[model samples]
Target: MCERNHPMKCFLATLLVAICGLFLHPATAAEDPAALLRAADRWRVSDDSLQVETRVQVLGRDGAVEKERLYTVFVQSGHRSLVLMRSPAEAGQRVLMLGDDFWLLMPGSQRPLRITPLQKLLGDASTGDIATLSWAEDYAGTLVGEESCEGQPCWHLQLRATRAGVSYQRIELWLGKARREPLRAELYVQSDKLAKQARFVLDRPEAPTTVAEMVLRDELGTHKETRVRYLSRTPKRVPEAWMNPMFLARNPPLE
Candidate 1:
């Protein structure tokens, strides 16, 4: 009787240990996602002036090459951002940025066209979602859980637009655990279809803040991909007039 009861006693002890491990594992996993989201949010640059050089590639539906262009962008926070073409023939045409407003100056046209709110949303050659810089204010975020990204452990997050007029309905983000930088993001429309995808790799860490060597790809038939490289950063005061559409068209700073 004693020998038979020994196996039953050992089995009960092992079962209790397994139950405790299951409960503790979830609690441990829960902390990482929230912590990573907070870290990414806290990371920001003090400089208001940002300069970026980008190479854009457009691919056809058959995965064939379409066209390519090189672009240079300069932005002063709350003031203006200027984007200009540097390659592929139309090299000198400029896009003036005053705050949320954007203006395009054609090569032959003397007057700059003030981009309307509706025009901003429309698919324009020079102006698109990349021209907009208000994502921090437009979207709200929540940490979902942990997931692996490219074999590296990462935190998954869900972001939703606070306003109805925003482009994407939902955005899912994967941030690297060790790097504390975003690895991948998927943008979804109201219908829950993936509209766009962005991947951030090659982190150029500047101490407390790290900027992404970014690759933004639009999954639409347009097949546009923008690769942005950080060129310079400066903390300079931005003039308020630069944010106005009328001001942007009238006064474009010459480089």
Candidate 2:
């Protein structure tokens, strides 16, 4: 009777071990790829008025301090977006965004000048249809593996642009384990050179979810650092009429 019960006990133990193994697996292993893609798409700022205050620091060749400049960014989805310099030279100079067009309003100039596509290509901003939210539309994202960023465990992902006109050819993103928020990102050019890297340190997980603090460092030619801080975010829809280029240049969003 004891020998017969020994085999039954071993079988029960094996079953329990298998059940434990199932629970120990990574949560993302069972996650649907399509669902994850959709979730990433849904992660956007749906606010009527969104503001970001930032301090940009230009670094010397030795990675030491250089100069600091302050700027304010106001974004109203589909309607208008404005970035104004607050301190140092070019104070009060603003970049206005209306619909698909972009214009720069100088501190002294009364008229807003349109930003050419070639000039946009040279800028740090991501190129292509700005309104789209899907990662697949702008980049081809693939799961790299589990990694660590700033001592926290994260999922590493590699995103490459599908089209040639895009700014960066590839981007390595470090996503938070629980929140799925992007913690860090590294941009790379077609020459296999590292262009820029950004680390998001402080995050506000409240409604109209905001990234409170971020440090962006350019690594390619000249080293430049930008620190961004979110001031406020309100859930409000923007008017469609405000998205036109003519309206953007005529009535600047700065005031």
| Candidate with maximal TM-score | 1
What C-alpha lDDT values do all the predictions have?
A: 0.59, 0.56
List model 1 lDDT by residue over 23-141, tens digit each. Answer: 86653544544455556643433344655555555555565556666666665665456666677476556676554455777665567786632232212123434443444555677
* Pairs in steric clash, model 1: none
Runs of candidate 2 with Cα error greater than 4 angstroms are 1-28, 32-49, 59-65, 78-80, 98-101, 107-140, 162-167, 190-192, 203-210, 236-242, 251-253
User: Against the hidden true structure, what lDDT does model 1 obtain?
Assistant: 0.59
TM-score, cand. 1: 0.63
Clash total of candidate 1: 0
Residues 58-100 of candidate 2 have per-residue lDDT tens digits of: 5555767566656565656434565666775655566655544
